[model samples]
Target: MLKKLGQFTLSILVVSLYSNITSFANNKPLTEAEFKATKLPYSVMAYSNKYAHEYGLDASKAIKLPKGLEAIKLTLSKSFSKGYGPYASKWDYNCTAELYVDKSLNLYWPGDHAKVDKVDDRGLQKSQISTAQLEKKGKYWVPGPYASMLYDAYDKTVKADLASVKLSFFGCGYIPSRYTAAKDGLAIWLEKKGGYNYAVIGQGEREISSKDFYVFKLPQNLVNSYLPYARMAAN
Candidate 1:
């Protein structure tokens, strides 16, 4: 009787532990209110990073963003906003401007979906942003020819069930090349049945092939600096 009672107690403890682990695994992304409380700038940047991870797009490179830049949600006239981009349908999806405080501004109208809980207020105040002022000071990183080629190869060749993939940023590095742009490498994680698999892109030589993928380690800061251009290439 005593042995059976002890086994029952151990089983109950194991079940309770498993339940707690499951709850943490499924915790929802931060809510809009929760994100706002942090008072951090760059909602779009945050969202893009999250998006990159979700779809296994590499955004591991460090970015040297413009100083004093911040994201502001604004309501613009329907006529002007219509010509902007696809991020907005009606005016309810206000434009999130990546503004370089009193300098340049680039606008993005993200959909009414929760990404990393970085929400934009629908009731955003009307815009003083003139159409002419939109891209005046705006500047963005551009990928070099080699990076662009790699991006094309990845986009055209890579395929996966994005929903099932887990984000993996194992860092990346670059080495100077005599012929092309710097040699680059990165590792990505993809989830498969019952477990995860490691895939890597060895030096930016030929187009990336699945067989050549293997893990490479380099400074994370190096990866971060290069990611802005990589993200641009992917886009």
Candidate 2:
């Protein structure tokens, strides 16, 4: 009986350790003090501070978006209607932010859908087009238009400039929907005269695409303002 009890305790310890490791792997945001301690480069630090200040980050709680920012509603193509369970597919679409500066900053909240839905006579849902379903099946549903718009807006606004900064925000599990439990984060794309650089904050650093993208992991508290929309959909 003593040996069996020891084995059970060992199993509990293993499970607890695994949970902690998984939590760490998900990449929580850094605290403001921790962020400062990192002593990131001036440009990166400055941009991050600006974003936090503008969005009003307070201990990673509720965030207040800036007033008067234009709202852009995103719509999915008609192909994602079927094969998606009702709970798996419902998302919020009204929380995006846009600004038209020398370059543009466009931020889409989580729960944005990538495809449209229509109900058939038999009460079954179907995508308007066959290709839309195929695209989702292939997991090719990342917001391509939004990304292109970011590039084009920056390109147009910073004509002849050496570089420019553009921001994009996503809640956990929104983009690349496969990672439903991903952390909320933001990306800053630096459009240089000859090349492009991307930095992500509030999540781990990794390459998001074949393009010259880079991720800078920061504490999720820094981006709490945009997380509610995603969280609502997730619930």
Candidate 3:
């Protein structure tokens, strides 16, 4: 009985010691003072602060953010068909914010939509065209589960970080859909806040046919869909 008890105590001691060592080594716990001192981009810090204060997430509960942005992506989405346009049966609107680690990280917005149910036996809006018909329009359009991710015809590029030329995306004439303010892909848009700039290597249209990201024409109403994860270049 004595031996067994002694062995048990020894085991417990070893385990406790090991655990303590592991904890200390595994996680270099940051002090509260150190945490506060962490430096971030001016724009990112400001944006993140607002998001955390207004919404409940850690500054990044929403998706669809600005490109080259380093804070939480706060967004709101309301369809035009609510009481005015169409698709009034089952409607949804969302408010979201997506967070990122830092300025170096790039975000990819995941898009997978729903079925376009036809109102009558004859059809729904614009009559759902088969993939074959849609494909011929351009190489950018893919058969998406929901609304297809927008793409551009011919590629384009720009300097977002320029001191004079502010990164531009989205306006009235270039609606993503006829419904949207941009006719190009959503993932390609960017804006240069303050003086900092973001450089684009490739775009969302296709597999590196060209190195271009679209400048989306964002309107006041559809700004909710613009969620960009900070993409950092890999070292």
Q: Model 3 segments beyond 4 Å from truth? A: 1-68, 71-102, 105-166, 169-171, 179-185, 190-235
Q: How many times do residue backbones clash in model 2?
A: 9
Q: Write the per-residue lDDT of candidate 2 for residues 53-163, one digit (tens) a residue.
A: 333422232222222121111111112323354456543322222222222323221123221122122110100000111112233221121122122112122232111
What's the true lDDT of residue 184 in model 2?
A: 30
Alpha-carbon lDDT of model 3: 0.22
- Sum up the clashes in candidate 3: 37
Tens-digit lDDT track of model 1 for 1-235: 3222111101000111211111112223334444334321211121123323433433452232222211111111112245346565432111122111211112112232212223233211111111111111223211122111011000111113111101111111121111232233222211112221122234324332222121112222322323332232222
Lowest lDDT 10-residue stretch of candidate 3: 6-15
| lDDT (CA) per prediction | 0.21, 0.23, 0.22
lDDT score for residue 22 of model 1: 18
For candidate 2, the 10 contiguous residues with the lowest summed lDDT are 123-132
Model 2: runs farther than 4 Å from truth? 1-192, 196-219, 231-235
lDDT ranking from best candidate downward: 2, 3, 1
